[model samples]
Target chain A: MPNADGYVRTGRGSPPVRTPTPRSRRRGVASAAALLVTAGTLAACGSDDGGASSLTWYTNPDAGGQAEIASRCTEEAGGAYTISTSVLPRESSQQREQLVRRLAAEDSSIDIISLDPPYIPEFAEAGFLAPVPDDVAERVTQDVVQSAIDGSTWNDQLVAVPFWANTQLLWYKKSVAEAAGLDMEEPVTWEQLVQAAEDQDTQIAAQGIRAEALTVWVNALIESAGGHIIEETADDPADIKLGLESDAASAAAEVMKSVSSVGGPAFTTAGEDANVTDFEEGDASFMVNWPFVWGRALGAVEAGTLDASVPDDYGWAQYPRVLEDEESRPPYGGINLVVGAYSENVEAAYAAAECIASPENQAYYFISNGNPASNSTVYDDPEVIDVFPQAPVILESLENAAPRPLTVYYSEVSGALQRIYHPATAVDPETGPRASELISSVLAGEQLL
Target chain B: MSTTTLPPTKKTEPVSAPRGGLSDRSKAERRLGWRLAGPAFVVMLAVTAYPILQAVYESLFSYRLTDPDNRSFTGLSNYWVILTDSLWWESIAVTVFITVVTVSVELVLGFGLAMVMAKALKSIRPVVRAAILIPYAVITVVSAFAWQFAFDINTGFVNSWFAWLPGVSADTDWFGDKWLSLLVICLAEIWKTTPFISLLLLAGLAQVPDVLQEAAQVDGATWWQRLWRVTIPNMKAAIMVALLFRSLDAFRVFDSIFIMTGGANGTESVSFLAYRQTIARLEIGLGSAVSVLLFIAVVLIAVGFIKGFKVDLSQARGE
Candidate 1:
């Protein structure tokens, strides 16, 4: 017999080969064609750089605020260079990952970046940021927020230019404060605030979720109590110091436990959004959050979702103190402008960064994006004061704000801290010591997570 | 059907003879086979095999993306650290638990669903099938968001609707506790994937031969007895195939956990742990190590199922 239809071979010492059916053979050809098309498209993906040199500035997701700034900077450039904005992932860690990957490969297309403050040290240590020019540094640093300057520096060198500075404020309702017979103008300790919430039969909203926000809260509480997470023994991981088990850390944990325990059912999982939502709807009377809440409240009122008088009823003060006598240190958060080390247009990038973070632009960003300006002059501007009635308190809070631990291993430290201190009520004196040890072990490569 | 056209093996050759008598036509046919398979094979190798090999190569180094200059060869230290770490073990345990619970639950529920679709009237079969497939068609991230919102205390009605129960409070947070959070994650996974399993099983059910079932019924066998002895035994291949696929998918649960809890409340799966290291921390070396371990674990799981079930995988895999 002869083989027929070319679909099978069954003879002599060979294993059987079942050939493809006509339909399957057609599918094979189709799929192969598709693969070629895909490969061709991938190969064709190269930059179409026309005559003009374009700078790509990577920014955190900011609802087109950064895009507006990019366009403004480009127009101001007067044909020297064009600026384009590429939105980074919304999460700070994700943004860091993308930037780090590109910088490690020395991708020169990355001209500038909007950086989270805590990751500045890591980027600077890795030499991913260009050194700030002396003239530009002097121009940007005048009347800047101290914490913003502190956050953008690594090894005493200003590696990035400060753009905006954010610090949490103790926001409360006037009715809740009066009901509890508490003064809103003077400083109030966390203990006093918790008691007042109990007295008024209301809740305090804070970020308790296991995220960078939780780490920010923990660091603030510890810093306010005169404790530091890392002592900066050296840039080396083995020499890093942790003050997690100190008396100040214990005090911070005490406040964390109390606030989280009494916060409510979802306290363990509440984040910035949850707390803000609850506060807007009157579920909570007190919240410690970034200045963005003020703009959110006003917007809600304008949108008719909130009562007209709610903005008037809102009151603000400096972040609550961890102890009665100690001055409270608000948590600092903001975006910094950093020039990419591998950028072909280093001079142009620095010029654009300086222009974008100028006092006038900082004030504009404050009003538009709700991000507090790092330049103190921006706060003193009449328009900023008119828009933010609590501008003075914000300036004061930014002064005393405690930046999160500046470490080259911030991602590792933050992850370990969030893990050990999660469900904030679980944080006790022991959590600090445990977290410190874990951080040390993780950094030293003895532990992996 | 075409077997009669094949050349007789006895006349063709002895067992040890070389296949040297092939005509030019046969040689051209062999070349055509390779030519047709070439592009897809190359693409598959580039996309899949290259990354896997690269991951294995990177796992041997001490590489952090940020600290690019500091990378040095570390031999097996990365793997050693992961093996010794309790967090890795915890993630693996969580992954296995999720895989077992979700796959088992999905298997039972999917079978029930497939049965309904299979047994329904011809007129309604299309509608029932479409409805069953709706969850599967929804994007994984979107379905996860829907479940996350539905279970949220402030934004959801689940708590208020179930508040009358003794232990269920009106202010309950579904993601607060470890067990409950895992339960909710499993619920989301099952809801999304049970339809897929049902679709596969439906095909197998079609091949189960209703005449055998009717004969069993005529012989005085109860419905349950017929199901256990006749129906299940006949659909063993389908059941095994579904288990193999669903279990592998469930074992790598990431998106739901990442969105709902961000791996908090002790809910991080192995894939999530790998993600945190590789993407969040930029620790490429350690992340690759974790990925390799996860890959090994998946292979072991597949082997276990294949060995225990004695499954003839060629049936499901096809020619």
Candidate 2:
């Protein structure tokens, strides 16, 4: 290249040299790198702004749902917030795991958590959730049934808002009882109930039907029997007494095994369906179920689609009295709604929770969802009375319902019981030694406790 | 490509060449390698690295799912609690048991099927292969449910068939019973995962030389003898790859147990228990500890594969 104007063609000397100095060039590179880094950092921090700050509602999506209750609520409160509703899997195990991972991850994205009451203590204790507002707690403490509150409170603090009640109830077929030649006037003692089912077993079996009843419904029977699942011992804070191997437990277990004969030619009378479906078919003479069965089973019964497998003369029992001790009463517990401590908008979340737990919503839960109301105040009210003709019974069931031991090892305990229940592990029916041994192994609590 | 090269360039360049010693590459070329890998690297770091770091940090605390005042940094206590606990060991035992049973079964069946398919009539191969895939094609949950229903009393087809039994004709609650549940899960897993294994082995089978088998036969070796000597020796690399793949998958089992028994009835694997603690109990610290332990187990198992099976993971695996 040559210089301009009067310059002749030549090398560097003829060229106008304007390359940046090494120092200037280094500065330019450093400044550009700094700009990029700053921009990146800003981008990273700004991620919380868009499509976030909007509150998320994790719940099951209803088929007929407005489908955007969260968004609607947030909108009604003005543009200050946007609420996003995420439909999470409703399976019990799945729900529990997702909640744990989110909180463990320190996920600030989720501000509201709908907790099942049995799980409330764990979340609250782990500091994943904030305390309920004092006013809300005080009011809920009064309005909510004590049984529901018992499960939701951890360390004497209100950790969740009671969504609705789930009190166990006796569900028997009114019509099937008639066919089985039974009177449905009053609840039968465990023995009498078995006898009555035995009376009609032949006929039921001949028709290819089987009678069924709950084996785990001992809590109610415990209260009625004067036994308890766990008794708080005044003797020691470190001690919780379980009557699992006690006479009460044996009595309950005997009752469960005895009841399996109801519609059976044999063990075929018992299956996983003993929990729910056994009573769905019109042939079973009796069943014990919670309120959810009302919508799923009774609705079919009322609609005439199901033959109302429960006896024509239905029987209701809170739980059959197991040990008959005055102090041993069955406990009631279910799920509850909680606000996450990591949630940014605590007040908004609180308000949302309050709305969800309102008496009207409680009624809706009873009528539509087949869940009993957590609020005791709504029980005798004319509205709930219509929704659940058995509402009075459920209310009574709440006063002295049993709650599972809220220990960290509760799952392990339940799992142990389930394992022992498996026939292979269960001792020979002729002798329960093996089953007893397994239960003892479970009770030994080496790993989980 | 350059078999005959020029004579070696005798010390043309000094040993300590300037910083720019090699090729005169452009800045873009220098950066292209990193840029090409940048997205995947960033993604890998975000997905795998951050969670692991966070889990390791959380493993020091003793947090309870049902209690709040209980959440505190216990400084390695959570790990101690898990490691020292008998529950952890039992779960690990169960996990190993399930993994070994299922993976070993799958390997044998898969290899057998692969061998058969490799030598079967060409016209029937496609049909047989498709039939094998039908099981793997079925969703895990669906397969579990099907097994649950078939073996179930009250409604299962198994019970109806059992009615014809000499004495135990009643509905026995097939999977609800211990040992039985494990057996059912093992069967389902074998059925579902065997095809994937077989397909891999089939690829390996493609590489085995027909001439090698003929040479073995020329020595008057029977089918079993020839298979054990010639075929298996040749397929060692593929078998190793398949074993490693299936065993790792089986170790982290969750779906079948979750659906069939919810970790009840002695079917709980380490992952299922971890899930229960993390989700059901809402104990973040404990759950994270469990997770860290799981990752360690996986690492150990991976090393075992390398050492035990003589796997060269640096090369392609489970191809």
Candidate 3:
């Protein structure tokens, strides 16, 4: 039973005392004086030097993984610029919040930015995105995914381009496909994948082995089945056009439930670690993730910590097309960069973005981090093909992937669905009613965005 | 000098003293005292009062941080939306629940620790106190990570040990379970904050005279009886201070829940909800409305507490 004084004092980096004596008094004065001195020094350090070529870039893309790519750009640009970068700690929603705060503060030091998708619209709407010159926007439009442009578009203005694009693609292990006695070359229907997953489970189990078929998947079920998580208008939420009421939507949920009931459980909360953890741990033989996981997971599998053959010995396919008659459409899941509409140095920022969008720099990003190009033509590049063999197959998914609805109330609308149809609504009993009610409310403008 | 001496004898002249009474000081001295402390006062005003005022001002308009230009006056509209929303009300309930549960648990745990420490032998007291403080000593992020790892599905130690417990499965995912995840967050908070409360109580306990306890024991009063009548009444003032501080801190908790559950699993606290709306959804006007509401709530609480306890706080502190 010691005094809690020590603990409290430690937070302040001092010991508890009744009051300051002459000796302690001196220490306090000296510290204050030192702080003032430090402040003065910092002020002097912040004075304009006028000609520094250090470019500060904000990104959370592989964080440290973007360095070599940046260095190469600086080198190719003849060292007129030295790239410095900071990684945003949060992704998507959280990142947008952090960025807004920074921009509102109007910091002069932020020379460059890397915005995530979904953020592009807000920034673009707020006019925070810097407008790229016609020439630059033209070059960018050619190389990046069309979906990537959505974040950068506002009133027909091009504000940013894709550093790398992320489109969710289907990844199935070769052994698992063979075990299920399914043909990889054949197009997979949602029903076919479900059937194959179970059959594969049985074949593997016949040898006293175990594997989960019908592990969790997104895009395929959500958008393909015509579920609309985002609404374009701020109206009565009750009229939301979420595809929950559609036949495909119900079918996807019911099919997912059936697959789970037959011993093919969805991915548990082992923390998908961006899907790699799910696949590499053998909990799933396939998953939907952006391209980067491929590069990092490659080492683990090769080292035998993971099933090495899972990488090369696999099949990549675009998300299955929904039944033609169904209303759901594929929604693209990827990253996009937009100009900070509030930036004073719009031209400089645009120039930097152009540098990143340059074919060589884009290739550098692809080589270092395995980021896929948004540029449609880059899929056909020999160098790109050699680096990412799955690129060609994944490209098809991008073309079909739909943009999440663009609306200010997108968060509220999406949140409603997330709440109603949690666990993919695939197996949850109350989800059908909940999702139906939520979607109805959204459509009616009585629910949310 | 001779005339003044004569006059002083006649009037029995007052002698000068080292320290003067209030009347002896000039207006300049009083003004100087206020001046010496002025910078700090102004700083506090800027840092605190300004933000509060800003929140109020923002609440009066449709303030969007992203769309700075569109922050036009839309008086009371945001407030109207929040008050009418059932989801907003649910957040209010969740925020209250977290605050009540966390503060109550911390108070009890902290008191128990304080009691143990207060009675320990001088030589061993420091060690025991330090041991009790180990939880609070860890940084919040590290502590959060520790709890998160303990509950991690694949590598978490809780899963590893769960099979040893009766009737529980090894593979149950703790993070996905709503109430369970919230409980984990609460536990993390209690573990971190208990020491702070205990220390405050311990300081209060030290001021209770030992003579009263001895007299009670001589009168054949049991320990519980002595504590209730003699110790606790003596500790009341300290307890109030600790309670107010703890209550305020707990009411706005956001970090642990955010880290552990990502505010998912149906545990959206008011602060987290505000964050999601303002930052995540770019609903700045709504966020400002929440901030203004929170400010008013705190003010009302303070006023209520003061009215309920008619005794002057300064006088109690002095005693």
Candidate 4:
């Protein structure tokens, strides 16, 4: 059993004891020293040149809009700084992971970060973000949507600058709405949409895939029912109080259960993109998605991939309500700008972030990239209205939307919720309690998810 | 003749150290051997042992990467939390299920493929082997995406192509149900890795002597009898090696599940759970605990294969 002996020896033997002759040992030590030197050099290579006037903005994947804005902000800086854009991964979670790892190492190359709203609290809590100067905070928050402002703030301080705000709208086909006799002019409830879908023999597409998108859907449902996912967040993880056991949670669960039946056959796996595809080519007549769906549909029509009649029949309204009498709070999403605390050029980065988020640049971003602007003033831009006909509804949704729970342990809470409330058809009255227990245990370090 | 054989057998006898220690020449040879292997040993320690030891150390603390201020020495509580959690056990069960099913299926399929490749015409052997190895050549992530798209209801033709079969329709969602999702994930794993198993088995098949089959046939044995009693017994080492490698590989299944379902509908593997904890949740302590446990499980599996199955790897290597 020499092979077994080899395995055991390798597993247990200390490497330092293996040196034999003095001459060879000396050579080995020298080589090891050389290797250490090389590793040190490699580690040192990760830092940038620390150019006094250069700032790097880590932006989420988009259609060159962030890069364009970087160039614009650089030009506007009047030689104060030159901003360069580096794209993060497409998925928000990947973006968070990359940024978190680099920030944990105190990497100074990241001067600016286009952060997702849900992760802003985590980054801010970690001290990975530079403090927002009082003047910068005031200017950035001015005229910004309330949800965006709320999303950008942590611990009662503006931790990040609100860049663009996104909210879902109830998109419906006019023909289907008329056929189901459902009025599209007013806000509708989830029950009404399900009923209409059932009556019309069509689908209501919502994000049910097990991802952050699902968390957004779950958060919106709970918020619309007037419940916060975390009733009280504490400095200690164990002290966090979850609102999942509340009546509002049950109501949200009930709505999810009801809606799942009309959410198409592949409802459990339908993400935003799948829902869009279903809406255009399949039986999905109603969907709750970001305003990008409009651009996608029009783009498809222009490319001759879709019939022009689809966009012609499109109608948008406020997000669906969980309860008939209460107003719906849509899910708030988008990018916010955070300057790295380790950045040598923090001031320049802040200035560039402000320029990138200006109403004029925001309007340009909205019109060009199909991302909504956080500044409410951008909605009134005539060119914006020309590009996105549902600009008013989007602005209203953004104003009324509720951002996901703000907490340092957001990923754990969201992961737990996504695990328990998934495959929406399985959600029942008891689902909320189960999810609450899981989240509580996870937060307390008593459970794994 | 007896004296000549005695001298040769004495010459073959294992060398024993002199009264107390190795002779000077033997010591010098040993030193030379160590010096030759020194660099590789150091490289392995730096790359493998250091990180694993770091994980073991980190597993003793309650640390979240995002909250450096609150890190505390929790001792074995992280291990306790994971050991008592249902999600951990459920993921273990899922991982074991995938490993068992995929490895067993791939073994039988790979054996069949090996037989085909081994018995194919000499002129066309390369073509057959190349065709069979194509899936193995494709990257795992790319293959996972291809399989995911194939099973996706919106973008896939699988539902439409199989609509004629009972219970499968254009509306069939492969990733919607736990069992169905696991089935798809296992299918992807088996498809991408069976070629590797087959290639290994093909080497094993080539090592089996043709004379034994002919001799068995000459002795009035049936084809099945020859295969069972002669071919299989002679290739037992090969089979064991193939099973051991494939089982270990299958146990760490992550890429397909990550790409296809994102571990939805209870398809989470232990590796996926570790990733979710460490990368997604940023709980370094908890994730390291998961990793240490996974490492232990892998070692246990390897040990089991070696001890319980008496898999003599030396023999497999033709020593």
Number of the top candidate by DockQ? Answer: 1
Candidate 4 lDDT, tens digit per residue, A55-106?
A: 8899887777889988888888787889888888768888999999999999
Candidate 2 vs candidate 4, TM-score winner: 4
**Could you tell me which 10 consecutive residues in candidate 4 chain A have the lowest summed lDDT?**
A1-10
Tens-digit lDDT string for candidate 1 (A1-449): 00011111122332333599999999989999999999888756635556556788998876467788889988988887788988887678878888888898899989999999999988888888989999988888999989899988888889999998888999999999988888877899999889988888889999998888899999999999988988664767889989998999999999999998668778989988788878887879999988888888787788788887877888889899987888998999899999999998899899899889988888888888788899998888899988888889999999999889888899999999999999897887799999999999888877876
TM-score of model 4 (CA atoms): 0.91
**TM-score, ranked from best to worst:** 4, 1, 3, 2
**Best candidate according to lDDT:** 4
What Cα-based lDDT does every candidate model obtain?
Answer: 0.86, 0.62, 0.62, 0.88
Give one digit per residue, the lDDT tens place, for model 2 in A244-272.
65555566556556654454432332432
lDDT of 2 by residue, B1-319 (tens): 1111123235566454456554445455668989999999999999999999998987777655444455677787667767887667888887888999998889889988998888889999888877776777767777776676666665567766767776446646665455777888888888888998998888777766788778767877888877777777666777787888888788898878876666654567889878766665456687788888898888888888889888765333423
Which docking category, incorrect, acceptable, medium or high, applies to candidate 4?
A: acceptable
**What lDDT does candidate 4 reach at residue A200?**
89
The positional error of residue B158 in candidate 4, measured at the CA in angstroms, is: 1.0
Across B1-319, the per-residue lDDT of candidate 3 in tens digits comes to 0100011124433355234544345466778889999999999999999988877777777655656775678788777777877777777777788778988998888899999999999999989998887777677766777787787665577866777776345656666666777788888989999998998889878867788778778988888888888887777767877777777777777878767766655677777776765676566667778877876766665666567754245533634
Q: Give the DockQ (2 decimals) of all models.
A: 0.38, 0.17, 0.19, 0.36
Structure candidate 4, residue pairs in collision = none
- Please give, for residues A112-223, the per-residue lDDT of candidate 3 as tens digits: 6776664565566655556667887787787566666764565566666766666666667777878877666755655666677666552111000000111113324656
